[model samples]
Target chain A: MTAQAAQADQLASSHGHLVIIGGGEDKERDMAILKRFVELCGGPSAKIVVVTAASAVCARMWETYDRAFRDLGVTRHVHLHLMTRHDANDEDLIRDVLDADGIFMTGGDQKRLLAIIGGTALDAEMHAALKLRGACIGGTSAGASAMSGHMLAQGRAELHPEKGSVSLGAGLGFLHKVVIDQHFSERQRLSRLLSVVAQNPYLQGIGIDEDTALVVERGVGIEVVGEGAVTIVDGRAMSTNVAEIADHATPELIDVRLHLLPAGSRYGLPGADDRDARRIPPPLLEFLENITKRNPIS
Target chain B: MTAQAAQADQLASSHGHLVIIGGGEDKERDMAILKRFVELCGGPSAKIVVVTAASAVCARMWETYDRAFRDLGVTRHVHLHLMTRHDANDEDLIRDVLDADGIFMTGGDQKRLLAIIGGTALDAEMHAALKLRGACIGGTSAGASAMSGHMLAQGRAELHPEKGSVSLGAGLGFLHKVVIDQHFSERQRLSRLLSVVAQNPYLQGIGIDEDTALVVERGVGIEVVGEGAVTIVDGRAMSTNVAEIADHATPELIDVRLHLLPAGSRYGLPGADDRDARRIPPPLLEFLENITKRNPIS
Candidate 1:
């Protein structure tokens, strides 16, 4: 199979849009990020649900997002605060979420957010909404962290990557194939992200800077929005000395492909663009080309 | 959180049954294993669909399984031959699978099975059938390997575990939390399974021997059937020197919990049994207990 055909096969199942934002999205400025979310949610007629489960100040967080949506001319909006697992099973809450055209998650503690809603009825409903109903799922900061199936829960920032500095946890899994990190450049989390990709090269590491968003139109393409750049650390062809690093010690990675994509840049869905201007090594390019040919997915 | 509550929480979302069989299940003798699958599919009235995508000799494979189901007094059984990705997207085929009471997958090459059907309309329909329509999914060997979200694609049979010895791939993901290996004792694949768990301790390792099956009634419990024992390698509490191992070198694992459960033995769903006769280390037991307590799921 050609690379194009293989990418098509990988994307055939995706139907929803994932609007993932980095931390500190400009809500007060032009609100471009939130506007993009509202636009994707089908404009003013969209029924949007904001989940502030991750925030310690749930009510305050809800008010902020609610006001933002209202200012954006969204008429139908609701707030869902699941403090405990039992709340995640509330029929009324589940109904509201199922009826939503879009679901937005706020930033705080991803662990707290997932602990309450992970593997619950609401969680299942959210996935169903995305898969079956084509509803847009948007998140920022901790919210973005909880979008992938395998999430980077917490980690320390260092110039050099470490073996066991980063920890992983289960996310809501709206997106697959990549581990997402927020506040990328501001927090200096490149090392931690590199460490994660070194261990699990199958997963690509996507680091979105503050105020930026990665708009993933399922089965179509991924577009970058907002101010900063989205750093993509591809480790599929990289060699790592991770296994040799002692526990909680620094790790050494070799030949990792890094792509610093600025706002307005887009990549083809399912596979990286082969004709991009960036200079990818011949061997690495051949390796990627072989994946589709060898697999013959379509 | 008590064990019962934790079990309840886990079962809250599980709505289907998965009969995962290791390779070499008896088909000619008493047909005990095949009968179990039919029984789970609702017996004589069961509408079974046999997926022969994994086998090279699809016709012969289909005939063998078709005869087994027919002999078991099954009235409605259809064959689904997904030779290519296009077949997996056939609306008629998806409809047939959607109406299935049971879906049986034959063993050959798991990669072939996934390559043809993974991320297709048929795959989505199958997941919907299991999650919403209460259909049973049963697979043998290659079929069983595709049951988990993270599958142990290929590996060598060695006594001492080595780094980078096993290859992992994406499965259909009907089951989570465990990496399954078939033809366990027959192939001596314990070391590879151990190595996988050491690197990703969040996932448990289950090795099923040939002629054996793990009957997973989602949200309830898993029961062992057929002949031989099922090895459950719990890695959550194990301390591994994996970070210090050289590339492709043997790994050193410490305090890994090994449970050799024979047929007729049952454990609670989600969490391993706490009161088993086999002595689990205090730290491991404490860690297991803390999962339910810390998360307070449901």
Candidate 2:
């Protein structure tokens, strides 16, 4: 495990559960990811606040999700469409979000969503609801991308990694240790994700495939759900020849550990107690062991 | 004073002092800023370590700083020139930095310095040295720019603020509440600084002029020194008409409080005791009162 993960583990496990879903989650079929979100939010009586700021079709998106939640038996839910910054600071709206059992953000443009809500009174209250009140926070697509403190704002997809291809921006900061990217397999965004991880080795990169979701119990564990798998890119023990690369050029990364986790599998996050029990892939183990031997702490 | 400053004031006032100097500091004439840095490091008996990773001419810069410190009567010092990531993880190098009385990072390219030292054992030790050992830390130019958690990597200087003009990157993170911009007046970076503040209103913008330095005694107060004035941009209660602006367009910010402090002036940072004594600029006072009245907490 990386030192950061260990440090995260040491933090008090009091923060709320984060249901971060990739784009195109199965809402009509089983609604498995949404179901888990509702379950975590106290089921039928869940006071869910749907944030549709990211979507261009805010009203229609809200109506669709409102019906989906109602179909899943969620009786108490509110739609919050923050078109402007003023909407974010609405005292009544802030109070509603603060009192919510679950706050879910829908998909569209992550930048637009953040531009409206980032650093506002509503943003502060959303953080408080999750950290202090243990309210379940969920997001999909652009919403999912906005979950991390350092977000993948926009980037081009490619098989080979290129420097300066992926652009990063400030997110809502619900997650601090990792960078999240959605529609992984659907868009072939491995290159962009790798570029981001290469640039920022301290941050772990999690690429969630379309229809998949990672249920993160902050400072504890992550459980994968939905139709596909989650790609865990560990750059902690990575060795990259990025210095040799020129500006806007492709970077060469060596020994970056990649873990493919399918649905139903649970993985220990930074602060998990049973970290040793989860088997490390051979390549990752070898890489980590080499790093430990080379850089032993006195 | 902003809420962040108030929170910073509440923190234990036990952290070390930070001598963050803007570019073009008067090293030859009087050497006032460097002398203050040396004094903060416990005077002549100070064990100072000079990090020249930012400079392309690392050896030359080290020798020049070495002579300056020596002329100021600092007897014990070491030079750290990290060209690669391996040098950043070097145990001996890490030990030297951690054991130093003061750690000074010279100017060059902030990205190069951060890319080499960021997320390494050396980076961790640097933080520990400042937080745990109370070791006075000093940085100039690019070094000063890299002191904040959110850094302004690259941008153009314009009279009007553009949305996508300024590019940001992760810094060494010694300072968390504000974003530092160096050579402020010389480069005409007010537009970019305002743009950044508009995008991320949670962070206050600090523009340090050439030959000026902001001496931050963490968790206590900030004292400006040298020839020019330091421009303080508070965006906490700012109202921006950014939603109306298109992509890569200029943003209009209203109610952003700007404070100009010349050398010898002191301002209470977060956790400061005599906050009330430091007169709030009339406009800022009116803005704060309006916010308090509008957003009254129950």
Candidate 3:
């Protein structure tokens, strides 16, 4: 385990689960990501709160998600959008967070999410729901980006690991030592995520491709869901010359480990009682080996 | 102390000092803030590094500070600006952080600073220099905002406390729990600051007017310097209907304590050896009392 990741807390709340969907989940097709989300909310009977605070068109976002969840058999659904900071501190809004079994954040801008709900009473309440009430909190795209403690606020889709490629902000901070990038492959965000990891070696970067999700079950492990792949960049033991490069020069990275997780594969995060050092499951290891055999980078 | 602040680290590392300057510091007249920074770095003999990563006109910023430091009689000076992530990872840049007696950040865009140098080797070096090497690290304007762990990335100078007025991001994070706002009175950022405090009750808000500075000594206390006032907004006991206000309606703030300290006033922080409960010095207290008597808001 890496130094920081070893000390970093689990992505899941133990009592709750986290579904971070890379934007563009197949809503019109298999709807696998959304279906899994609803199922994780204890299936249909869950009281789900759809937060469209991040969306520019909140009402439309709510309508679309409401319809999707309803189709997935979710009976109790509510829409809570913050038009301003005032709404973030409302008692009713906080109550909504407390009462939610599943809290879903829609895509728009991560900055909007932080501005509207970052550290307000409603923010406290949402955390309370996740930690205390065991509510499953999830989001997509900008929503997914807001889950990390050190959030990636904005950045261009640079192909090279150069400086000024990304800007980070404080997220809802659901997870630590991990930075998430949405629409990973589709948006060509690999270099962005790499830049993030290169800056903070202790951090483990996870880039989720479109139509995919990285499901974190606190203290258990992470599972990839949907059609695309989940890329994990581990830089704990890596060596890099990120400190001495020129203005436009690409950074040189060595010993950085990359893991590709497809649907149905499981990678374990060491839990409180996690023993037997090998955290990777045998099946997951076998899959990695096969993939390694198929395409050797070195 | 507020819950989060109770755990928040001191603004100054135990080994170093912190000088956060509001924007437009007087480079022409007294230059008291700059003088203090220089003095803290052990005077004219100190080797100083000025980081202009935040500025768009990097060369101009470097030239301005270079002249100021020279006027202050500092012989050795270096300029380090990360034009790209590569520069941030440069070994020479890291060495400069280690070798410098004082490191100063210039005013520009806080977001730009984060984009160029937020998490790179240079960021790590800056932190290391302060914490381990006992080098005094300081900044002005956008530089000041970046000192806080939870930085106020951008915000409008609204006269009333309202939502959607500001966006918070990840700062250099030399300090925690406390948020700093530069060009406070000049920009009329009271409502903006109030909104910040309301959203994050755990954070103490420091709004420094232009030409002024807040000097924080680790585990010791803070002192005001320069021409203008430093507005300290303590919302630990304040109550707000922020969780339930309308979109444009001003937030009703109750029980919030505001302290306005002019130059030469010393405020006490609860250090490890802070024995007495009374933190405010008797003279400072008298000043506050006199001001309160002069202007009774209630």
Counting clashing residue pairs in each candidate, in order, gives: 1, 8, 14
For all predictions, the C-alpha RMSD in Å is: 26.7, 23.0, 22.3
Q: Which digits, one per residue and each the tens of the lDDT, describe model 3 over residues A29-55?
A: 679999988777766777789999999
Worst 10 residues of 3 chain B by lDDT: B289-298
Model 3 C-alpha lDDT per residue in residues B1-298, reported as the tens digit of each score: 6522431233233457789999888886778899999877767777799999999999999999999999999888889867988998999755777778789999999999988998888888777777666678889999999988889988876534666677789888887777889988666676688778877878878888788888876555667788776766667766555677656544545445555565555655434343542366432343223211211111
Instruction: Write the residue-wise lDDT of candidate 1 on A1-298 in tens digits.
Output: 7644543343344356789999898877699999988877767667899999999999999989888888888889998878899999888766889778799999999999999899999888887777776678899999999998798998887544657888889998776667999998667676678778877888878888899998876545566798876766677756555686577654434345555555666554234443452333332343223211211101
Error of 3 at B19 (Å): 0.5
TM-score against truth, every candidate:
0.45, 0.45, 0.45
By summed lDDT, the worst window of 10 consecutive residues in model 1 chain B runs over B289-298
**Candidate 2, residues A1-298: lDDT per residue as tens digits?**
5633542342224347788898898878789999999877766676899999998899999988999998898888999877899989888766788778789999999999999999988888887777777678899999999988899998887434666788899998877667899998567665678788888887778888888898876545567788776766667765555666676664544345555555666645433465643443333343223211211111
